[model samples]
Target: MGHQYGKKGEELVFWNSQKQAVVSNWIDVEDHKFEPPALELISELLTKPRNGLAPDLAVVAKAEAQLAKVLDVYEARLAEFKYLAADNYTIADVLHLPNLQALMETPAKKLIESRARVSAWCSEILARPAWAKVVEMKLKAHA
Candidate 1:
């Protein structure tokens, strides 16, 4: 599930932008308004150290704090809509799966599970067959 784009007279544009480009094309939604939150999640939560070395406690704390604030907004939005960016599942929601799964392995999992709406959303997204397949492939690779 990647995208390939190009101008008629030029070469194919592959990996030209970020996840936003791939998601926008795949879902065909005007997701401009959703970019900031996605970026925030990536920067705030996903950027944390995970190099097999124990991370600095302060760094983990800071990231969790930021995650709490972000999840607060999501909790409110989720009260009205089904997913993060919109009521329907979008790349914005898909964008969080990998990192959110990683975060769940840490103490920060409580931040997500404690929120009813956010927890429900996470459960639904993470349970998708696509994600399950990804998980299976990863386990096989590691094995």
Candidate 2:
């Protein structure tokens, strides 16, 4: 990636060293935004209605069971949790951790524990520097 200046004091990504042909021009800066909302919302939603139905279980058991199967894809991925493309940490860990903890700490214990790889992966990622950064941030706030 390259950038060319147009007599102005702004940096732009230049494409093939030509004018207005930027492959990737970006303003680098700090972000004042919260966590990316969509991923955060899924993690939050996964926490509710363990059977994956609406808050009202008034629906039939078969309906609830069908909804619960939505987790199978994730559970299958847990079989490859050891290969999440990060050595021992990743943004995936951040996205999944909260909801995972909620599951493990609830009646869903056996369901979660049935997969050993998931447990190990979660523990390993939680022990990494990336996750530790969040822990430190929380500690500082409480202190």
Candidate 3:
């Protein structure tokens, strides 16, 4: 099994029979491959400077533009389906959980909430007990 400590000190591993590896610091894993927009978003967020420390407005704007493109794709798909992979929630939707939770608290939140379908989808996912439990554990750990 492939296992290691990620940059943020999170444990990363390849799980399941398919040997899916954890991607970035998000609680997402796939079978040695990533579906689009998810893979693209992960790469964009990881490569850019953290929100507050970005050197100038241009950098932030550029990042936002890139993120917008990805979000547009998500919004369009969500408009027709309950989840990214269709009606059933799958790894594709699971992969967005952590990142979306964080994004909901940031200025970019409007980018999601402004889109009706995306907002509804986020609400449904965030309300899941599994996600709630994860949030509880994270809060307690920080406390």
Per-residue lDDT of model 3, residues 1-143, tens digit only: 11433223322333343423212222232222222433344334443445433334554456567667766766787777776654655555666777777666556677778888878988999998978999999999999
lDDT by residue for model 2 over 29-136, one digit each (tens)? 001111232223334344455557443233323332432343343356556545232233323344555544444444333434555665566566566675578778
lDDT of 2 at 50: 55
Residue 98, candidate 1: C-alpha displacement in angstroms: 0.4
Worst-scoring 10-residue span by lDDT in model 2: 25-34
lDDT pick, better of 2 and 3:
3
In terms of TM-score, the best-performing candidate is: 1
TM-score: the better of candidates 1 and 3:
1
Which scores greater on lDDT, model 1 or model 2? 1
Residue 83 lDDT in model 3? 69
lDDT of 1 by residue, 1-143 (tens): 32332334222233446634643553332133333434344444545544434445665566566667777877897898887544556556766777666666655678889999989998999998878999899999999
Model 3: lDDT of residue 130? 73
Compute the lDDT of residue 135 as modeled in candidate 2: 70
Off by over 4 Å in 2: 1-71, 84-90, 102-104
Which candidate comes out best when scored by lDDT? 1
- For model 1, the superposed segments whose C-alpha errors exceed 4 Å read 1-52
The estimated TM-scores of all candidates read 0.65, 0.40, 0.63
Candidate 1 TM-score versus the reference: 0.65
